[model samples]
Target chain A: MTLALYVPRQSAVHRVPAGGKLLALAVLAVVLFAVPTLPVAAAGLLGVLLVGLGAARLPAASLARQARTVRWWLAGLFVFHALFSDLPTAAVTVLRLLALVLAAAVVTATTRVTEMVAVIEWLCAPLRVFGVRPARIGLVIAMALRFIPVLAERADRIREAQAARGGSARGLRGVRTTVTPLLVQLLQMAHTISEALDARGADDEPPARGRRSPVTAA
Target chain B: MKTKDLAYIALFAAIIAVLGTLPAVNIGPVPITAQTLGVMLAGGVLGARRGFLAVLLFLVLVAIGLPLLSSGAGGLAVFAGATAGYLYSWPVAAFVIGWLTERVWSRYTVVWGVLINVLGGMVVIYLIGVPVLAAVANLSLWEAIVSGAWPFLPGDAAKAFIAAAIADQVRRSYPVIERPQRELAGR
Candidate 1:
């Protein structure tokens, strides 16, 4: 199964209110868009990095792993920008993107999925006046979060099986072969999960009643 | 809801987040991201209403500036870009996908489910996304499709099939959640 990506950390970042973190992320994104210089963007990125280090108390090693995953995309963005735009502009764009990404990564690494859902549920409370069901919405968020790792695990198993069967999915062709089976497996898994939900009285629940309350206590 | 159900939702959301973080394959204007897979699965497995809600939750995170999108792209500005159509179409796509799966393909085998899910989800997305993209990017309909929608087709199709197959398997192993009895009877 695709394991949950949340690194278990009892750090300041994790403890910070989800609302605050979300607000900060929004502000940072805006600044990145408004700022137009490489040096400035780079400084912004560095600032974010420093905050991440302090808030998440992320070990240097974990930071490296995160960087490694992003390296290819960063390189690709750099190359694309260099080819299409001026060098300085390209650098700034790339740095801006990186800063945004790293900041997000820090949030994900520290925040638990349940905490996110709680925050979402809280935020959607105002919609109750519009006849929205916060609890139902919360349920949906919860389910999607559950399915990711399950689907990932199934995908991994299928890939391994394909490999065992001598499937040479090493390049573009590999993507095709690998994706086809993965798709097939994903469908099957979804069906299984749906059935499980049905069997578990999923249908018995009444349709969300009266305008959903805006804030459901998590 | 039971704790298990709560757990399932939490798990799927995490999946969506992690998948978003993965490196994207930049085919062109629209980079291939894994959020679509999450979108499809959310609908197919959770049914229309719940699936829509899940996508909304994810989008809320994005709106608040979480870099939950592919390539660490998030924030309100991301919503104003050329790719906004695809991003915004997610909830609608998930609702359509779940509705179709429950209505048309509930009893079908993995292959049939995959086919319907892929076609259904893609059509809805393109229908909404292509037009919005054309308007935003100041491209003609055809040009928007070519630049914004075309590159993602093959990848999305793959995701659809994957979602269908996995959903089908999950149904077979646990037959209880397949569909409402009334719906099944109509089929």
Candidate 2:
């Protein structure tokens, strides 16, 4: 069973409203883009990472688990940048990237998926005037959250099945084999879901019911 | 939320995190990740509201600094990178996917769902991502689309079809929790 990276801690950071966190993220994103100085960006990134570590109370093991997948990419980027760009610029760029990723992960790990939905609903409330239904919007958000892990698991299963059937997805060839099965499985899965929704009468509702929300309240 | 629902959310989130662990297709500008497949499934299965919520959950974790993206990419800085537009569009794409899927509820046909997924999810991503790519990467719109949006189209289409099929199967086999109104209406 694939485990969500959400740590489920009752930290103050977790309690912070999703809207506020989003706003902060936006501000930081702006800062990251606006600032041109490598030193300043690096410093900002470090500060963000420090705050994220403190807020999430992340353990060494969890942190390692999180970083395990990206290490190779990071290494590749470092080497590529080092060879191409000046060392200082590459270091700064890499650090900025790492800091941003860490900050977002902290938000996801600490906050409940439901709360995130609530926040999105709240954010989209303003679109109601344009005919958006917050309830429907919330439903969409909830489903997206739910499906992430499901598809992930299914992809893994398909890959394993293909491998068992003498498919050697060992390198580049393996990559192609893995992707093809995953796609095929996904197509098959979508057909099954559409039929189920039809049986459940999902299509009877009017499209106007899905109008954009107008109020963006906190 | 009920325990079951919570369990469902946890399960999906885990799926997303695991997908994040997989190797990404590093084409230029933006790498294709399996997480988008997760995003598409969220919409196909959960309808509009819940599907978008799920993407928000994934984004929140990314905001809080967890490396929950393909190639383990996360952090506030990612929001400024070339792929930010695509990453940011996940929630909206899910919403669009769900809304469209809900529109074509024709008895679990994978093709219909795949059509909706592509039209709603992938199209919306490009609509939002292309301009953002232009601005962030300092390229023209055409150049950005060619570089950022064009490369991912094939992979995204595959994901859309897959999500549609999975959703169809789930609907057929599983006993979904029906909304009270739908139950009352007996449709």
Model 1 residue A53 CA deviation in Å = 3.9
| Best DockQ among the predictions, by candidate number | 1
DockQ each candidate and list the results: 0.29, 0.12
lDDT of 2 by residue, A1-218 (tens): 12245777767887788767766765665676567568877887777666667765766566555455356777777776788777876676677666655556565666676776687688778997997666555654455455565775676677678778877555435434454445445444544554564576543454464464565321
lDDT of each: 0.69, 0.67
In terms of docking quality, how is candidate 2 classified? incorrect
Best by lDDT: 1
Pick out the ten consecutive residues of candidate 1 chain B with the lowest summed lDDT. Answer: B1-10
lDDT per residue for candidate 1 within A68-155, as digits (tens), equals: 6667777877887788777887788788987877777676667776777778889889998987666656655656656655665565
Per-residue lDDT value at A46 in model 2: 73
Candidate 1 per-residue lDDT, tens place, B1-187, comes to: 4434444444445457667755678765678887788788777766676667567767765786655688677888778777788778888988887787777544667676676666657887788888888988799999988987788877887877777766665555443234678875887
